[model samples]
Target chain A: MTEHGEQREVFLGRVRAALGHTQTIVPDEPPAVDEALVRLATHDDDLITMFCDRAASVGMHVDRITADELVDQIVAKLVELDAKWIVVGFDSLDQADALNNAIEAADIQIVNWLAGGATMDVQFDTDVGVTDVHAALAETGSLICNVDAKHSRGLSLIPPVHIAIVGARQILPDMLDYFATQHDATGIALPSSQAIISGPSKTADIEGQLVTGVHGPGKVFVYVVEDV
Target chain B: MSASTTSLTLKGHDILFPPLPYDMHARADLATGDDQLQRFINNATLSKDLQRREVCAQTFGDNYDAMRSLAAEIKQHTLDHLDHYLEQFVDAATGTGAHVHFAATAQQANEICVGIAKREKLTQCVKSKSMVTEEMRLVPALVKVGVEVVETDLGEFIIQIDDDAPSHIVAPMIHKDRTAVARAFERELGSPYTENPQELTQIARNHLREKYRTADLGICGANFLVARTGSAVICTNEGNGRLCTSVPRVQVAIVGIEKLVPDMNHLAVLLKLLARSSLGQPITVYNHIMTGPKRKHELDGPEQMHIILVDNGRTEILREETREMLRCIRCGACLNACPVYRKLGGHAYGAVYSGPIGALITPMFKGLDKYPDLPHASSLCGACYEACPVKINIPKYLIQLRAQMVRRRITKWPDRLFYGLWGMSLRHPATYRFGGWVQKQMFRAKARAAGTAGRGDRYTDRGWLSKAPGPLAGWTRARDLPTPPSNSFRYWWKMRS
Candidate 1:
């Protein structure tokens, strides 16, 4: 090992030498990507059914509901968790006004958790988190949420229960499709933080016994709106 | 030992893996003698191996091997163009708001981290599961700097309090049972002893949640680094990883130089393979991609972020014929499939990384002379190759390393002299025939003297050598050795014709 260490130039220079390079030059194009091997679902597949089935398989609760029943179902679920203080990123979701009214009428206080990054104080006090997914993956039943000013990264995490409202139109055939839409012609555009959540937080650390709700939400409820 | 309010808590035993490679056979001997440990590790590895096969088959169907091939090509491509990608990644990450640092050694890596912690005056640290940090032994170094680093991951938390090293890659504590966890918790956290995994998990959760809420610094490891986005991708089943990156004011990710892929499309290919190959999950619970610290107008994220790209001994592997081994994703699939690893477990490998891949790269990362026994640890079994997601071809590299050992005169002289004479005998027909005839007659005479004569397969008469003489004695120490056939292949062919 070196006594102190090398600078970035010196370190990368050693890397170049190790790879049998005489001097730094333009690197060759990356390997040709074959999409046939990666993509699991396609346009022909029923993305909604596939997403629901696959999502349920990984222990997430998935329900197909119309726009009208969204309020009742979410309220019922919140009541089921006995949540008094909840966090909501409803401004980004469809039917945001009605949902907020119903949640407020149900007497659950909304806490702030987004600014200054996943405020553990509020997240720990909040019993449930509600948000809208940027995209829903059919191939693996994953929910993608990108962080923004309106949409906090903590609404789906740091709570005992997570309730997500996914638009049926947002469901993509595969994870590759989500990436295809996320990028422009120039290159892939990634948000500062994008969470692709699939299952409840769990661990098999002690003797390989599966335990749920270790640090993240114990239960994740994904409600797919049919006519959003 | 009697049953009472408190059952016998699992004894506290530290796995004293020395700084460098040591007597592996001695460790294997101790591990093989413990019946409970042997059975536990055997069942766990076997079950995990079965889960990987079934899940891969169900999810990918006939396209499984093709996906592995694609993933392998992507990793191999990145490694071939590592210098270029490294430059690209540094530029992209810096352009986004990440402070990227390079460390040539583990000490340098730790010092860089210590510098960051000291410069910011951050004392309390919350860390997620990171194999790279374990390689750096970052916890102790931070502790030495008066930084109270807390391991927030469940397995690592238990490991930290117990004063132990992780035994497996994904499931770090597969070697220890729940009783051991209960004991560790009761001893360290002053919690009551309970063998229930759920209760023990709750105990750890309650204990670590406080650290997450109060920590000023967060430490994490990368599963993949996307050069195009200049992002670090982490896939974790528990929520601790996300909490580590999101909860603390300052976030740092310690990544190996080998983890870069060109773009998100390439990341998709490898991510599909990593979790399914690891624990039969389609993906982990939280697959969070951090492009940089929290952006402008963003409410939740770290104020400052740093990426430490460590090259402790990787360039050595990169420059050698074993450069292909760097394609590993650290999923631990090869460990579950390796028979020697299944029997002896990871501690016997005597390195930060363990199993078939470890047996190859650990010796290369360190000197082959320091770990000469590791290459010979395998039965040349191809299970590890078959199970690998990135298609490492571990057995081939192991054979290459063994050949290197012989070429370097690392092999003992007595065995070398014996094998050299044995090779000469096989070059000529007369010496080969005489040697075989002499060997067959001696075994036959010995078996008859021992009165252990029996049918080879209930038809042909063959003796069982229950007791052997000289160096051969070790072969029959645990199990009997079967005698050779009555006639050689040449003689049999001549008789048939």
Candidate 2:
């Protein structure tokens, strides 16, 4: 309920008076923006190279590998992280059964997200978060984390380490494409929360010293699995 | 509003930082005398300014200026028709299962937020970084209502523990160093003191994560509120923004109406410039776009989302003449590029905002008469204008504010009389020439008397005065005044011809 029922009307009235409008007016069209002026990267650029280079520059470790290496790489990476437990966002990957089997054989515990009422508290105890990105951007090397029934918002955050599996086909050239893609995919109905991740959570606040993983993942590793 | 109330602490809880001292001289004296402030703040702002320039130039190359112009145009267009876009936004957001509220003043905004807490029976609150929330003095207000609110941003967390005010818009702790963080943590959080920034950051990270996990309600400020989608886009590098909005049961975003952008494409342009201008990053680490509360099928997110569109004093600024000032994206580029802000630091401005943009708007927000010194704070160097991503002509607006001050008699009569006489002198050739002749003779006489004349430069024998007398003394306080050349330009031109 509104604290004051008429406050909205009163506030809008004042705004209308200030704008000298008898009625609220939306302009016929917004100011025209030149695409050429606003866009930094074009479709002609090699998106894979751009995404890899830009992601690495921002401190995220980016690797390009064939899909054949996907399961082995995932297992090797988990061993390298020394993971006691991992929070998985999606239920399926390329080889879901084989992947779980590999992880179990490697002695890594996968937290059952559905087994608990306090999903977040359980996720907080994990060493890493692993998920497949909705899309990646070449322009800024950002990963688009779209939240839905199949995916959890905290999977890409909360944990100290985030490992994202991005497919080459899912990479977009610019942020403009991400927005455009959303309009086409859902037709104005967006996910509950859409986050664009460019790099690990970092801060330069304490005397301008750069520190990563302050409140989010400190290390972000992106594996761009090649699409066959 | 009383300038002398150092104990602006509300409800016996220190929610607000002590206001900047009313006396400009005292404020400047404190900044100029502090060696730590001189070393850290000066180096940070100067280097950030250079980084901003290099990155923007490197990325945009030739279209940078035009892009800035486009950004300015979009913001201006939005403000011109804010009423319509705001209405559209309210309806669209409401359709997304979000509650929209309106607040006409800062007090009203706080009351509405407190009202939400009472109705929902919420106690623990976590907040991300927001200048608007700072303007509302939200933390202390919530504390007064018995709601424990924790500032989640690393710098803001330290600031809350230390009972200090933020000193920068983006990097709020720019005025402090690792030593201050170490001391604050050791005393307040019971952590062992460590002057290393990396260690200090780790301590804060551990502490803030617990708050993020437990907080029942979250508060945030929006960088841009998209009217078309009924969405609020929050840009943060630390990822706390995601946790604060995601982990809480209820999420409340308090935003000034001026944050509205017409569409998503417009948001893209601003986002491209926001990080580059502020921190030299191509983009912030987390650009979170939230449409509404968790849907029936969504796995995780806040169950309820409330957006309070706070007018505060933005409507007053919307009066066409000052409307362009609202185009500021709050990138802090102006602060980084400002000579005065770099020299004095942010706290000297005596407001939540500081630097060139602050100099223009702070007076307007808190009466020119109350903060009369702010209008004249700059040297009118125009670096701020050059650096503004949205192209706010800060120097031009500052001059207008000074003119307004003179017209309204906010300036002292003596200073007004001096400028007025100086303006009058420039009208006539005879008086102008006469005034110039007198100034030259006096400067030369003073230099000669001080034994600093003509021995200054071997090549030209031009004299310099280490100090000047009377009203001119302030100019020479920090620097020596070069003696006026022997002959007037008019005389020399006449003689040459």
lDDT of 2 by residue, B1-497 (tens): 45534433232123223444344556677788998898888999999999999999999999899989999999999999999999888987898999998988898889989989988989999899998988888887888988999998988888888877787889988887777778889998899978988888888888888888888899999999999889998999998888999998999999999999988888998999999999888999999999999998876789999998888898898888898999988999999999898889987777788899988988888788877888889999999999999899999999999999899998889888887888888999989988888888987887788777666455336677877875788998899888787766787899997
lDDT of 1 at B126: 95
Top candidate on TM-score is: 2
Model 2 iRMS: 1.3
State the lDDT of candidate 1 residue by residue for B10-96, as single tens digits: 221225235343557667777789787798789989999999999999888999998899899899989888988899898889887
Docking level of model 2:
medium
What's the CA error at residue A109 for candidate 1, in Å? 1.0
Report how far residue A37 has shifted in candidate 2, in Å.
1.8
Please tell me what DockQ candidate 1 reaches. 0.59
- Give the poorly placed runs of model 2, Cα more than 4 Å off: A114-118, A185-188, B1-21, B437-470, B478-487
Top-DockQ candidate index: 2
Candidate 1 lands at a TM-score of 0.93
